[model samples]
Target chain A: MTASRENSSSFRNHTLTVLAIVLLFLFLWWADGSMAEDLGLSFLPEGLNGYEVQILNLVAVYGILAISLNIIYGFTGMFSLGHAGFMAIGAYVSALCVLTPDQKEMMWIIDEILPSLAALHTPFWFSVILGGLVATVFALLIGIPVLRLGGDYLGIATLGFSEIIRVLIVNATPITNGSLGIKGIPCHTDLFTSFIWLLVVVFCTVRLLSSNFGNVLKAVRDDEIAAQVMGINVFHTKLFSFCLGAFLAGVGGALLGNLLTTIDPKMFTFLLTYNILMIVVAGGLGSISGSIIGSVIITVLLEWLRVVEEPLNLGFVEIPGIPGMRMVVFSVCLLVIILYRREGIMGMREITWDGIAAFLSRFGRKKENRA
Target chain B: MSLELFLQHFFNALTLGSLYGLIAIGYTMVYGILRLINFAHGDILMLGAYFVFYGTTLFCLPWPVAVVVAILGSAGLGVLMDKIAYRPLRDAPRISALISAIAVSFFLESLAVVVFTGLPRPVHQPEWLVSIITIGGARLMPLTLLVPGVTAILVAALLYVVYHTKPGLAMQAISKDIETTRMLGVSVDKIIALAFAIGSALAAASGIMWALRYPQINPYMGVFPGFKAFIAAVFGGIGSIQGAVIGGLMLGFIEIMAVAFFPELSGYRDAFAFILLVVVLLVKPTGLFGEKQKEKI
Candidate 1:
């Protein structure tokens, strides 16, 4: 009877957590729509209003990227610096799929080729999924050889891979459109759609983390040799985690591409990877909640700094004439954080209901003891 | 590519490879002693290049004097980095050290940008070094010849220092067993600092040469070479100096030749390094010259 009661109570807590998440998602969605309407923001150039909504959509896209990157770097304890490459692969592929049919009609050479592919037009959503699949395939291919190598070696390999991808994108003229970049891509990303996608990704990610597989992933991260000895196929586990991470990164890239309505090789550089890596490190490794917090903090801080550098200059205290002062300040903050709070804000722990309950219980216990 | 172009490209590869080898020596030396990969080493190379640029342009020093000053400056910076960023994390987990190293790398790059601005400065090579020398059918710059010769001499000197001197023995002992070396009355900290100092000096030397060859100096220039040199260090065997040199040269040769032969695949130059790294790791995780480590349960 006691065991059944405990099970029911746990089930109730799980349902409550789900309900809370759902309510939060709905609130965010409503807020996003209302903000778009209130500000008269549009996601595209054709619309006069909705600039705020477009920015919000961009934030959601980057938030997805940060969360996806967290899966590989934070959750799996893998130091991958090639995430931008995976993102580029997805962006380029989707751009190609979206542009090829229309491009055939305009370009002489493309029109002479198999007209059937040109006839079968793909929607933005289909292109996004295809982009993600292509990126996932690339991840698997790249991960197969490098994932077995642990620590710094993997980091180096991934960095090399990303650079390689950038070069390939630049060279593949017919596919990636070369240095000119793939322009006139369909703009399908908006605040509502982006928020919905973010919710799905966050939900799936949180669910995956709470599952049995998540436990195994954490175990492998804690000690790979020990985990391997205990019968977990360490290679497969890493590959799965890395590929899933890559897939989400691909989706993020696709959304970003759609939002911008263009794809450029230069857009996916090591700098992008570094920025995401910095966010993950600042968020706290191996913590989902930390990633969300870090992404919001970094994105909002970066955007807000534009105002700080411009019209909001303090009177009688003129700031320096340097253009990239914000980046310098950001780097200093990163160094200070690493130097002092090396474990980050929350360390490796998560923000869970149990944690909150424990804190409340401790406060009550302290009061009782004082009495 | 034509025969002449192919030969020139090969020589170009060799010159580039030698510089990489020079930098890889520093990376291997530091890793050998501490088992920690210093991500900031490449930025130190950038610092060296900038120092040389300033010494030559601002201070009106001769090329040789500028080189010497740059090398010394980089060595001092390396020691400072160790003291500030890495020394405290020695007792922490390896991952923490890695993160700290990364943070230090970002800090250095940002600091460079703040000081120098993001503009790419032109590195003016001395006219004597810039003059082309034709050997038989091939054309070569004086700098190219100087690079290989200097690299070979430096490697030889490093080998002699590691094998012939008492300090070398102490370094080797610490690498083999840091605790045992300390128990035997060796100052492990001083020896390790010495290794970093020497490594930083070499990296600075390579950086100066690289800037002269490329003729462009940017704050973030070290990112690619730093990563490639790390790959080279791994290819040769992380802890081995000779291995690093060989690995670096091989990588340089492969990258240049690959681009020269297949102009269509020129963009894949970095990919070749990545693929080479992946292949090397898959085939031999211990590396070409590395010994397999057996851990006690």
Candidate 2:
């Protein structure tokens, strides 16, 4: 009887959680459309430009990317600097797949379009999934050879792969449009779409992390040899984590490309990967919620930090913007974080409901005492 | 290839190899002691070049004096970077140091961008180094000969210091076992600083030579060469100095010869070194000259 009661309560809790999330999402969807004034007041302030909204969307995308990276680098103990490359594959593939033939014709002015790819077109959702799949395939191919090498060697090899991928994208003129890049990708990404994708990705990641496979992954991360002795196939587990990370990275890339309405070889440089690395490291390596929080903080701060990179005007004085100052500040922050707060803001802990409830109760007791 | 073309490619490869080798020594030396890839080593090379540029133009120093200034400045910066960015993290996880190194790299590059502006400054070549010299049927610049000659001397000097000197023995011991070296009476920090100083001095020499060869200086210029030199160092063996030179030379030859033979593949030239790196990692992770040590389980 107690078991049945516990099961029903658990079901009720799940339903309540789902209802709360759905309500939140519904509010966002409505605010995004007809309730622009309300959104401007509550979600974002009035007088904010389109660029701010775009930055907000990027935070969602980066959240998903960071969590995915956490699976490989955090949970699986593989240091990969190739997230940008996978994202590039996703970006290029999705962009190419979704662009109209007319748009392709306009964009590929530097070289003739490959006849096979010219006529190809898929819907936005399909293109995104296809991009993820393509990235997964590439990850598998690259992973087979380089995954055995641990630590810094893996980092360099993956970095090399990303560079090679970038080179290929630049040189394969017929397919990627060379340096001109593809423009006019349909903008299908927005707050709601990206939030939904982030939810799905985070849900999947959480489920995967809680599963037996996730345990195996953490085992390998803590000690590969010990995990192997415990009968885990270390290689296969790592490969799985890598492919999953690549898949989500691809999806994030697709969202970024569609939102920006352009895809370019230059967009997927090591600098892009570096930014993601900063997010992962700052978010606390192994925490899922930390990834989300880190993504939001870093992405917004990066955009906000543009103030330093732009000229400031006062009533009586003007201070010219110093280029690269934004990055200088960012690197300093990263250095500080690495040196002092290496475990990051969240460490390996997640934000739990019980912790929140206990804090609320404690606040209520404090008010009672004051009274 | 004709004899003239062959010789031309050979000399070009030698010059390129020497620069790569010189830069790789910095990487290998740091990696040897710390097991950390000094990503900022490339930016140090850039700073070295910039130091020389300013010394000559802004300060009106002679070229030789400017070179000395560049080397000293680079060495000081290298030691400072170690003390500030890396020394604190000596007891931290290796990944932290790697990240710190990357941060240093970004910091230096961004600092350069702010101070030097984004424009690529034209390096004024000393007239003595710019004159074309002929060897048999091949024509070359005198700097080409000087680069390899300087590289050889530097490598020999480095080898002597590493093998015959007391600090050199300390470096070898630290690389083998850091804690044990610390347990011994050696000042680990000083030895590490010395490694940084020597490595940066070599990097400065290469950077000056590279500027002489290329004649243009930009804040972001050292990135590609730095990566390629790291690849060269790895190909030779991370801890082996001689291996770095051989690997640098081989990479230089492959890069030049591949482009020379098939001009169309020039677009893929940058990819070549990375491909070589991946292959080397896969086939021989220890590299050609690297001694394989059993992992202490």
Candidate 3:
């Protein structure tokens, strides 16, 4: 009887938690839409502008990227700097699929796009999936060979592959339109679509991490020889984590390209990979929810940090804006976090409902005493 | 390609490859001792170039004096980096050190951007270094010969120091086993710092030459050649100085010759090193002269 009672309460908590999240997402969706004024959200004064909405979308995209990286580097203990490459693959493939032949013709001013590729067109959702699948396939191909290497060697090898991939994209002018890049992509990515993808990614990754396979990944990470002794297929596990990370990274790239409506080969540089790595590290390497929170904070923090890049004035004095000052500050933050506070906010722990409730109750009691 | 064109390309390869070797030596020496890839080594090269640029233009120093000062400054910075960024994480997970290195790399690059400005500056090449000389109907920049000659002298001097000096033995011993070397009463930290100093100095030399070759200087310019040099180090053997030079020269040949022979594929020039890296990794994971993998147990 007590077991049943506990189950019911836990199920109720889960339902309440999910409902709360859904409601929050719905509010954001409505506020981001044009009809927000009609709903009498006068408190907001003005509904979110394009910049605000774009930041929100960026949060979702980065959330996906962080989680993907968390799986490859965090739980699996493989230091991969390949997110940019995988994302590039996903971005280009999805863009190609969704562009109409007319759009393709207009975009490929350098060289006419391949005749076979010109007619390709798929629904937005299908194209995103195709982007992810292509990335996954490419990941599989590289992962098979590279996974044999471990630690820093693997990182360097992956970085090399990512660079090679970018070079290929640049040279394949007939396909990727060379350096001109794809422009005027239909802006199919908004907060709702991107957040839904983020939810799906989080759900899947959380499930995978909790499964027996998750234990296997940890075992491999902690000690490869020990995992091998325990009859684990170490290579296969690393490959699976790598491919999953690549797939999500690809999807995130697809959304990012749509959100921006343009992508040049240069856009997918090592800096992008480093940014996601920073997010994963700052969010707490092994925490899923930490990635979400990290992405939100980082996405906002990046935009907020733009203030440092702008010219400053103190009534009597003025300081010219430093072009790369923000990145300097950003990299300094990452260095500090890695050195002094590597566990980050979550420290490999997940956010739980009871933990939240307990904090709230303690706060309420404190207020009562003060009164 | 005509014989003259071929000779010119060969000399170009020799110049580029030796510079790669010079830079790669720093990578190998540091990796040998610390088991860490100094991601900022490339940035150190950039700093080397900038320091020289400033020393000559901003400070009005002579070219040779500028080279010496730049090399010293970069070496000091490298040692400083080791003290501030990497030393604290000596006992932390290996990944922490690697991450710290990456962070330092980014920090230096971004810091360069902020301080130096993001614009690529034209490096004023000295007429003496860049003057073209025709020998037997083959015209070549003096640097095409000078870079290799300087690199050989420096490398030979380095090999002498590493192989013949007492501190050199300590460095080798440290690479073999840090704890054992410590037990033998060697100061590991001092040796490590020495390695960084030497590595940075050599990298500075390469950077100055690289600037001479390209005639342009920028904050972020060290990234590509740095990575390629790292690859050359790996190809030669991560811990072997001789291997790194040989590997670098081989890479330089492959890159220049491939472009020279196949003009159509010049666009893929950067891809060659990465491809070589992957191929080397698959075929000989330890590189040409890297030590065999030994399980600690």
Candidate 4:
């Protein structure tokens, strides 16, 4: 096809993709538990129960988070373990914003709510954006000093930062309610908003990666020395990637808090970061599609894995559920992946139709050869 | 604070700092040889504590015997962690090894939860160590002074081994240049394992002392000390043993002193270590005793 024709066709494809997503939202919204039951469409996949819907919300939140981490660690080659910290900032910011004064009054049992904070409130959208912006601000401050360090030093430093953030949140009783975390924050996130946020983040990330800036980021990741030799201003590029990732992570955290309708210091810890890292590494470090796909698999798997924590039965005997078995299994799986298959599911490759066709053709060829 | 109070805090700082220094050595030694953070080091320290917990309670072994057994078990575990988790990733990307270390850390933590249960159990503090002694109008347990003294002696013995032994020389040579040392007919893997063994033993010792001081044992107890010790290692210069100990002691003093000076900010005690680490890393990334590293083109 000619260049203009190709552009027009691509634009049409984009429109179709977006419209398809919108249709999905409309269907989901219309077919929610009550609606579907009334309409006699309760058995349909779209008529998800509360728990199933939660998994979807978690997928979207984690999809966004995994993408952010993928960009930082996969595309830009920065090993950051601060997503949990950023998410906590976002979660606290958004929760505090959306909560009414009465709710704040009820929740702050440890100390009286600050008068100014009690008065301050914002729409969910505005509050979420503010959370992202605030987290970005933190990332900017932290990145300026820390982006200079390389490898594990940067890793440890970022980990330290997240711990520090948690510590601050725990100690700053007036602001974060100290260890007695906020409760009963109004639920603001649903499938529609979360998916929209994920789409926007993924779209922006994809566009950014395809641009000149993305190339510079990959260059810096592959070899900082070579990128610097080519005059690519490595520090600024790294700082940009770090800040962007933090901003998205912050947004994800906000959505998570709203979805859970609760916020606490204990919730955002290394394990939270570890969950996102597992998704990122499992999906493929540098691929956006990989993150989404990985998010779906890992989220569903996490929910499914909860079965191990419940009582089990055999023909002859019953065994009590193991409390921490899920984490053990998850860690072992990750270890096997890291040890045996370091590239993960997608590696550096994206899921293209052409690639899919090629994979199928190879499968067909193998079948024919076997015959 | 009164003079007696100040002295008591000083002893507290010394004991805590020595324990931190002990754990920090594990991190520094591992980093010096592998250039890997051994994220599992803290978890290994946790395992060491758990081992002691079980040895005394499960087997009814004497405290000293249990301690020795726990240290040995930790050493074995450290070496096994290397052989299994890290060995295959020798040629892989450095981050792969790091992620594996992370996996092992959580695996041990969750495993502890599974085996030892998630609840925090009180450690068995021997009567001799728990006994109070008065010094300069400051009353403290015998364990306080014993902890630092024991740590000092272990560190000195470690220094002598690292400087005088053939295996220690091999470890130093490998850290400088793994390939060159390999070419020089050194058993690099064995030496690396040896380093892990020693580091893990020290971590276990630190864990035991920490348990005695706090009189509590839990799966997650190692996480904070592990982090602070790593910070200490970095502060002292990541690859330098002496630097790690000094860094550990300094960190302990800073944390205790800062809390003592401002009781209101005691809740932010953990933040002090992270902030100190960030500042030290920014000022001199190589740390106090670390040699300057030049980036190669």
Candidate 5:
């Protein structure tokens, strides 16, 4: 009886913890609303402006993307460079779905099936879900044949897939409007929506990581041969993670498309995938919190570099005209980061409550011990 | 399409194929020796073209001198990259080295962007090489003739080096077993560095010729060709230099003919490569020229 009581108490604690997380997320969402008023703060020395907010939104979206990629790349040990392709699929599909019939007419082949989709013109939220589903379907198609190949071969295959997707989008003028790009997307993404979506992704991902399935996935990453011997179904695990990763990427892309209010084939290039890969590597692969921290750091650093390129003359020593200097600096930093922190900043460790407690105790050992 | 047009594109395809073959050789050689993809190889090619561009336009050097300078400069950069990024991680897992290679590639590309800006610069073709020659009722540029000749020479030289030289024997030994080669007192570092130098030199030569044909240079110019060349290397069997050359030429021919036959699918040119890669992977993971290796548990 006593043991049963104890089990119930621990279960209650778990419930409370979940509640607390939900409350914190709600509070953050509310805070975002108030922060919207200070959009101009981005422009001022210490203020954040609308543009900055938008950039932050982009970072949040990319954070979700990087985390999802980490699931496949870090956990499953699958080297996929085609995350951008999945994202593009989601973005274009979602954009196609959410846009009004008139808007569709302007962009895609609307005359044939306009009557059917016109009635079911779903909301932005539904379109986002639909987009994720579309991306998942595409992932399944690509993953089935390609996932069988291991290591560098898989990487090359995925990279090729990304290029194919890009070129297909460029050529499919009837549907994608070709390289001219799809424009006039309704601006539905903002801090509140992005923050909400970020929370859901984080929560779902955390839940997934804590589940038994996560252990099997990690096992595959650690040693594929051993994992296979243990009857873990390595291929299925990889495919699942790959599909989920692609799905999250799709959702992120949907949000990004909505935020930018425009979609271009060039925007979803291999460089974008490389940027995300850099973030994942810098943050520490296989660490979810690391992806979030890394995304914020990289996005902020990229934005701040604009200041370096400003036409500020430092009296006698004038800065020369360096057009793409930021990318140069960014790449140098990436190289340094890879050299020094090959395991990344967090080294596959997450920021848990125990870590927080240990950090707090360093400053006040006596008081923390008493507590 | 007219017979004349077909003949013209065929020559164009051959020129492009040979250039790809040159670059693909570098990829195949590095992969053969180190089993590393050396993703930065494409950027090295970009650097080579830029070197030539600067040599001719800024320093007023003749085209041949510029080409020589570009090749040497590229070879030096290749050695430096191997020493800095790859050598330390040689003992680590293959994936770690690959990631580092990718990072290095990105760093080089970004650095190029900073140095040369994102704007496209026109590559100046030498006056003598700019003229078109008529053959079999088809117009052919001097570059068309030069590319195949250079490719043939380079392939022969590479074959001879791999088969006849002491260093080639050492490379073959290392590729078979690194520890055994080291036990034999072969300087692994020097041999590896030499491989990189040769690979980079080939890439540089390819880049110069590519620029001559395309007449444009950009920081990101190498990305597509780099990928395609890598595909060519894979298609021909990654560790086989002869295979790489064949793979590259075949890829080039397929791409051009695909575009020529189906203009509607022209935009799907990149897609064609991916599909080919996927099909090859599904049917034969070891690639066309790749030897089957037993997997050890």
Candidate 6:
């Protein structure tokens, strides 16, 4: 193909991909709405109730979070266990921002609310962005020091920072309402808001990964010393990715708080980060598409596994619920996957239009041969 | 503060430091050989406590016998963890092993929750162990003094093994270069398993002591102390046993003293360790006893 013709064809492919994604989103939205209402949609998958819709919202939020973590841990090769801390910051800041004055007063029971915070309230969208920005600032401050360390040291430091943040949030009652946590915040995150944010995050992350900056990060992940020798300002690149990841994690947290309509210091524990880490690792490190795929699969899998934890009544007998069985199963799955398929499902490969086209063409050729 | 109060704080710091040091040694040894952060090291500590809990409560064993059983059981579990989770990934990318370590950690924690439940349970100490003693107008439990004494003894034993024994030499050689050690016909796997056994045995000892001191045992009890111990290991310089001990002591002192000085910020005591870590890492990443790692081109 000529250069111009190739460019035009690629542009068309891009448009088609975007349109397809949009259509998928619309279909999902319609289906979700119907499921929530228990309206007739016999041809579709079983409709989700209000509770299920909430779970689906969590999936989208986690999808954004998992992808953002992928940028830091997967792409940049920084093993951070501090994403929860960033999420906590976003959750509290955004939750506080959107809370009405009365709600703030009602929530801050332990101590008198700070006057400045008491007076301030941002729109939901603005609060979410602000939450992300604040988290980015914290990440930048933290990354400057911790990013210099390699491997497990970085993970420890970040994990420690997260614990510190949680502790601080518990103690800083004036601003965060201490450990009592903010309750009854406006529920602004629906399927539309969450899906839109995921789309934006996925788009930007893909673009960034394709850029020179992304290449530098991949190089850093592959071999830090070589990247350093190749004149990459390794620390700056790492810090940038770390901060960006923190920003998205912050946004995800904000959405999560809104979705749950509550926020607490205990909610953003190390386990929260562990879950996100599981998603990133299981999705395939350094793959954005893998993060999304992993996020949805793990999210659904986790929810589905709740069955083993709940009491079951069969005609023959009744099985008692085992409270921790779900986690046992999940952890076993993680161990098996890591041991056997360390690269996870994607193995750093994104599902691209060209690849899909090539795969389909090969299938078509096989069918033609059979005919 | 009065002299008695100061002394009390000093004793508190010592006991806490000793526990940290004991746990840090395990992390130091594992990191020394495998260069993989055994995230499950803390869980092993929890297992030690649980094992004793079961031994004493269910089997009606004496405290000392229960303690020994806990240590030995924990060592066995540690070796098993190495065989099942870590040994296979020895040649894979470092991160894969690290992730596997995390999986093992999560698996152990969840399994603990399954078997033991998540509720915090009290571990009973013998009356003599909890007996209060007064020295220089400062009141202290015998357990307080015993913890540090036990830690010191264990450290000495570890030093003796690392410095004088054949297995110790093998451990050192393996840590220096696993491939070369293998080439030299040393049983690298055995040495690595030995490291886990010793490391986990220490974790068990400390866990039992921790249970006695705190009187509460839970599935997640190991998480925070485990993290703090890792910090201690890093602060002292990873891969250096002596460094881990020194680091543990220093962290204990910092945590105790910070809370002592600022009663208002007592809630932020955990934050102090991390702040210290970031400062040490930024100023000197190798830690106090750690040699700087040089990557060859």
Candidate 1 lDDT over A1-371, as tens digits, reads: 99997798688678878898778665555555554555566652232236656667766887788888889977888889889998998887777667657674554242243455445467878888888898999999999888977777788788888888888877765555566676777778876678788888988998999998998889888888899999999889999999999999999898898889877888998778877877777888888777777777877777666653464456988665555666767776676777788777767888876677778899999999999
Q: Considering TM-score, which of the candidate structures 1 and 5 is the better prediction for this target?
A: 5
Write the residue-wise lDDT of candidate 2 on A117-178 in tens digits: 99999999999999999999999999999999999889888998999999999999999998
Error of 4 at A19 (Å): 6.2
Give lDDT tens digits, candidate 4, residues A1-371: 69997798678667767787788676667645555666677565556768888898899999999998998999999999998999999999999899998888888877888899998899999999999999999999999999898998888889989988999998888788999898888888988889889989988998899999989999999999999999999999999999999999999999999999988899999889999999999999999999999999999998899899888998789888999889888899889989988988999989854566568899999999999
List clashing residue pairs in candidate 3: none
DockQ of predicted candidate 1: 0.61
Cα lDDT tens digits, model 4, B128-216, are 88888999999999999999999999999999999999998998998899999999999899999999999999999989889889989
Stretches of candidate 3 off by over 4 Å are A35-45, A358-371
How do the predictions measure up, each by TM-score? 0.90, 0.96, 0.97, 0.96, 0.93, 0.97
Of candidate 1 chain A, the 10-residue stretch with the lowest lDDT total is A107-116
> Per-residue lDDT tens digits of candidate 3, residues A1-371?
99997898799788987998789686676657644566666565455889999999899999999999999998999999988999999999999998999999888988889999999999999989889999999999989988888789889889988988999999999999988889988999987898889888988888888899999998988898999999999998999999999999899999999989999999998889999999988999889989989999989998999999899998898987888899999999989998899787787988877778778999999999999
- Residues B1-297, candidate 6: write the lDDT tens digits: 899999999999999999999999999999988998899999999999999999999999998898898999999999999999999999898888988988899999999999999999988888998789999999999988999999999999999999999999999998899899999999899999999999999999999999999999999899888989998998999999999999999999999988887798788888888888889888888899998889767
Q: lDDT for model 3, on a 0 to 1 scale?
A: 0.91
Q: How high is the TM-score of chain A in each model?
A: 0.85, 0.92, 0.94, 0.92, 0.87, 0.95
Candidate 5 docks at the CAPRI level of: medium
Q: Candidate 6, residue A352: CA error in Å? A: 1.2
- TM-score of candidate 1 chain B vs. the reference: 0.97
Full-model lDDT for every candidate? 0.83, 0.90, 0.91, 0.91, 0.86, 0.92
> Candidate 2 DockQ category?
high
In angstroms, the error of model 2 at B96 is 1.3
Stretches off by above 4 angstroms in model 2 are A1-16, A30-33, A36-48, A314-317, A362-371
Tens-place lDDT per residue, model 5, A271-326, is 88888988998899999999999999999899889876676688998876576778
> In terms of DockQ, which candidate is stronger, 1 or 2?
2
Scored by lDDT, the top model is 6
- Evaluated on the second chain alone, the candidates' TM-scores are 0.97, 0.98, 0.98, 0.99, 0.98, 0.99
